[model samples]
Target: MIKEKTFTLKDNYVCTSQHKLYALFSFLSARDAYTFLCNWFEKFPEHKESTFYIAGESYAGKYVPELAEVVYDNNNKKNGSSLHINLKGILLGNPETSDAEDWRGWVDYAWSHAVISDETHRIITRTCNFSSDNTWSNDECNEAVAEVLKQYHEIDIYSIYTSVCIGDSARSSYFDSALFKTNSRISSKRMPPRLMGGYDPCLDDYARVFYNRADVQKSLHASDGVNLKNWSICNMEIFNNWTGSKPSVLPIYEKLIAGGLRIWVYSGDTDGRVPVLATRYSLSALELPIKTAWRPWYHEKQVSGWLQEYEGLTFATFRGAGHAVPCFKPSSSLAFFSAFLSGVPPPPSR
Candidate 1:
């Protein structure tokens, strides 16, 4: 899979270039994605008949559905000669779905997990109107949020139970520069360092070192004709300046759900960023009828997490997992993913 140029490109790339003006928006990004997919299908027409499912995690919760809607709309246009995408459904992990719900959940999660004191939680809950666009402008709310950040500063907020990277390696600078930036906008809040698999505290550091090497770049053709120097897991410049994102993608979810797409929303129960509580709140707002009652899903004769099926969607949780579900609970995540692809529920009992 190719990285999005808006976040990955460096130096003379359109997103980073001083001469070009670029605004990152979900709908625009979706249109560009549709183009990419069309080109891909053209090149690999042999796979055109295969079932196509869009999948992503974190912020992609917004992107995947928007892109799917675009594909869906295009396929249904009469006299439209666009290649038909055999689209089926989508999957998301620890997605940022709604602004108000996410903020409420973040504060509630911190308080419930004993990360913040009773007073701080009380002040925030009393003073902050999460539904307001300018909730952070209130002094009490701002102070309470600052306290939350201060407490979370010590631990890996992405995975609260994990150890922080304290290595003195040369790449520590990357870790320091990358992880600590904060934005006033709730949507631009700092994200965790990229994680692939397992719970290694210093995995991001290792990844940065490996990807920045001359030989590695050469082998991957990452530096060809580009003035790429440093390779970061995230680009804060793009993140902080992102524009045109709706405060919530819940409306998009409703539209896609009505279109009969096999939507599944999952969470890593321990992620403090886009926590499970946030997902629960966001999905609850849909008010979809329950098709399958909530219960524990099993993997390898052990409890993986809970699952519930809505009329047109499914929701699941990964026990003890962090922001990156597969990275934290690989085996359980695999079983969950297999069930999704098979158009069946995850095993209800061991």
Candidate 2:
């Protein structure tokens, strides 16, 4: 069914420190992405050991670093301005930490999954700028990789339906300034009441994936022509390219990592789109000395995940997961978030 889905207006600039690995920082914007995030940190003190995290699925993985950077940079600037903002660590799940390495991971994942064949994997892997000479000729290796991926996908979907996990949660799509009392809150005119986007928070669908054009027109308080025009600016940006042609966010993350922030990057082991291996390579460019060697930490009886702690950054892997780690491992995901929130180390893996 060729359904014309209408999207919210997109901004020309994301207003972040850098493009998230693959757009993780989509939520950080001049509009409210930055404002809300900064505010979240500022208000965290009210909650004991409040650490602000830039969390989400798919694109959010990419958004984490930039959002963290924006908060950090802005906090410094605010303190300079005689205002104080207490910013802490970042928490990201299934994050897109590296574009360069991410592509490599994607190829590796496709190669590993039965969804794609050996021929297809070879074509994708070879096409990337950094194709590894590493070859897997054994049938056993191929079968194992495929099984690993299937297990990952299975765990991911199970979590989503079972928990209040939003799958494609690009915060920009769901944000309503009105939700916040500050001027930063979503303006009714700029958006059809944000309430329209999945009023039920329990369900993960925050933004209306199916943004109906007719509903949008009807919601605009202004005349249809003017409302349509305004809506288009925000809507077009959702799925289409905005004022600029190309997409990028590496500079933003580079800014944060270079600035000495506690950047926590974790991924679902099974997710090919943003694989754990790819994240490691992305950090390799930073050339930071590994503060701690790679090791496993546990949530309970099972081995939770592995960690690579650099002086300023840390990378973690969710053992049996896909893109949505929290949904896949709710208790563990919550524990991880709590750690990010409290600057506490998770239980050691057995």
Instruction: Give the range of the ten consecutive residues with the poorest summed lDDT in model 2.
Output: 187-196
Per-residue accuracy of model 1 over 214-321 as CA lDDT, tens digit each: 878877888852555688766755675666455677776886788888999999888887889989998998888999999999999999999999999999999999
State the lDDT of candidate 2 residue by residue for 98-136, as single tens digits. Answer: 444555565465555544567656644443243222323
For this target, which candidate reaches the highest TM-score against the unseen true structure?
1
Question: Cα deviation of 36 in candidate 1 (Å)?
Answer: 0.7
Predictions in order: lDDT: 0.74, 0.49
State the weakest 10-residue window (summed lDDT) of model 1.
9-18
